[model samples]
Target: MKNTVLITGSSTGFGAAAANYFAAKGWNVIASMRDTSKDKQLNKQENIFVTHLDVEDTASIDAAITAGLARFGKIDVVINNAGYGLFGIFESFTKEAIQQQFAVNLFGAMDVAKAILPHFRAQQSGVLINVSSGAGVVGFPNASIYNASKFALEGWSEGLRYELAAIGIKVRIVEPGGATQTDFLQRVWGEGKNASIIPDYIPFLQKSEEMYANLGANSDEDAVEKIVAALYAAATADDDQLRYAPTSDIQPLLNVRRSSSEEEFNSFTNGLFLGK
Candidate 1:
């Protein structure tokens, strides 16, 4: 039987790309978004089912899972990719923005996992592939809030991995460095608390975005395909890795951070800020 996978936030970017990638590979792809009506592309694919899934809403999540299970017969893997970035100074971020970010990035993912856990547990087999960022491993300037969300996801996945492994449910975290075309940067929300005033960290944000916008020397399709492949491996491999660093920049930096001393890592990161 062909495996069926559900990917959240499939209306665009990595999620959309991965949906097509997996569908073409013969997996039944549930290309889910908060508003399926907006996803004309996914609706056209015979192997793909575009469904409505709002991670922030419990009812929507449950309904989406039900609808997905009904249409696909079974959900073998879930790609929790429904998240956005909230950029700007941490201090400038208002309570609302911080809450909203956590709602979508951390809690939303947890909620989806919960909604699917029962089915996975019953079947004694499933995979949860979380779309964390390189920021999930380490922090950068002016992205404390976004970093916090990804860090929380890393923490959750680390614990959940061991907890579910014995039960045949596997989990993995994907740490992609940068993909400029995503709505992640353009749709960035600034916390109203201190943004209008412009904190000293504003330059760091500008520099980071400027440097990031220059990445992906070739087509991002290669990167997205790598992520989809990693997700597939994480789902099917008996002895799966807990983390998959899918970008060129992310893996090297992860290696350095893992091997370097705290002082050395900090010094290197400081240089990045100084643009050295």
Candidate 2:
């Protein structure tokens, strides 16, 4: 019997890569995304099921899981990877936008995990992976909203692990560093660019712009492969480990974070964030 995985945000990036990886490994994959039209390749695979799953809508999440269960007979893993960046001066963002940010980044993952638990419980075996970011533990300039959502995800996932482990379900968090698809950051600034019309914040915003530019963070083809490998490990591993990095790119930083004291952490991170 082959194990099956259902992944969210499969239209592109890590989610899309993970779907292809799992299918190639002989596991059934339910490659779900908010817009199925964007799924250009996975439909060609015999074991991959492409479906619609708007994370903000519990109905869509529930329906997608239901469809996957029906198609694959059983789902052994759930990868909650559907989220976007919402970067800007927090003041410039409206309450609605912040809410939507959390709706997708935090609440959406929660809803997906909640919806899939019954199946996991009944089988007494499963893995749940939340695609988090380095931003979850470390803060960056002008990413307060995005950071908050991920921080909440980190905390929630950590707490939920204890609850799920006793039931035979393992939980894992995949944390990639600042590097990610350019389109992700572009989508963020595109909507909030013009909104930064408040003159009083111009200098700070300009500094943030320069800082982001200087970071030179961008994902390449190899990154997709690394991310998929991490996802596969997280889904298949039986250990009590709760966190993973796609590559050594973020390992040193994560080690520094784990080993540093609060003051040392703040000082170390400030130098990176502020170019001190």
Candidate 3:
């Protein structure tokens, strides 16, 4: 039987790309976003069913899931790709900004997983793929809040994987490195109020912004392909994998951190922070 997959934040970036990828692969795609009217491209796809879903809103999430199941009959996979990055100096981030990151990134994913678990349990087979970041495992300068949110997602996915294994519900984390072509960077907000107070961090912040604007990050096309491949593998692969590191640069870094001593890791992190 063909599987149906629901993807959050399908209006743009990785979500939209993955939606198209899966739809082309013969799966029914529930391409979701905060407003279906805003998703003109997704609405045009024959295999895609565009639906409204605001991850930050509980009512919207529940309604979207209900609508998806009603229309598709079964949601075999849920891709938690609705999230934003609040990039700024650690001291400059506000309580509200920090909360917003967790709300959409961590809480939103958890809420969707919680709401969908019942259906998966009844069916006894399902997959959840979370779009985490390289920052999920590594910390960077001027992205403290963004890193924290992804870290939370990674931890949650790890625990959920173990809990749902017996019932055949699998969970996987996709850790992509910096991808510059998406609106993801443009959607990132930084608090000047807190950032201004940290005078020493200004130079580093400027450098980071320049790098971001020039698209010094990785290619979005490559990253999206990796995500699609990982999602497809997670859905049908015979063996289990806890994590999928999509970016080549991040894979080695992850390995180093995983095997290195705390002191070695700390020293490298401190040097990077100081240099930045």
Residue pairs whose backbone atoms clash in candidate 1? 92-194
- Each prediction's whole-model lDDT (CA): 0.81, 0.84, 0.79
How far off is residue 60 in model 1, in Å? 0.8
lDDT string, candidate 3, 157-253, tens digits: 9988888998888898888776352342233334333333566755665666555544435445476687778777766666679788866656756
Per-residue alpha-carbon lDDT of candidate 1 for residues 1-276, written as tens digits (9 for 90 to 100): 789999999998888988888888899998889977778787898889888899999998899889888988999999999998777667766788888989999999999999999999998999999999988888866578989999999999999989898898989888887746344233333433334444465556557766556544432447777777777676667776888886675776688789999999888877765577
Clash tally, candidates in order: 1, 0, 2
| Candidate No. with top TM-score | 2
Structural similarity to truth (TM-score) of each candidate: 0.89, 0.92, 0.88
Instruction: Report how far residue 162 has shifted in candidate 3, in Å.
Output: 1.3
Q: TM-score for candidate 3, please give it.
A: 0.88
lDDT of 2 at 61: 89
Task: Score residue 173 of candidate 2 by CA lDDT.
Answer: 96
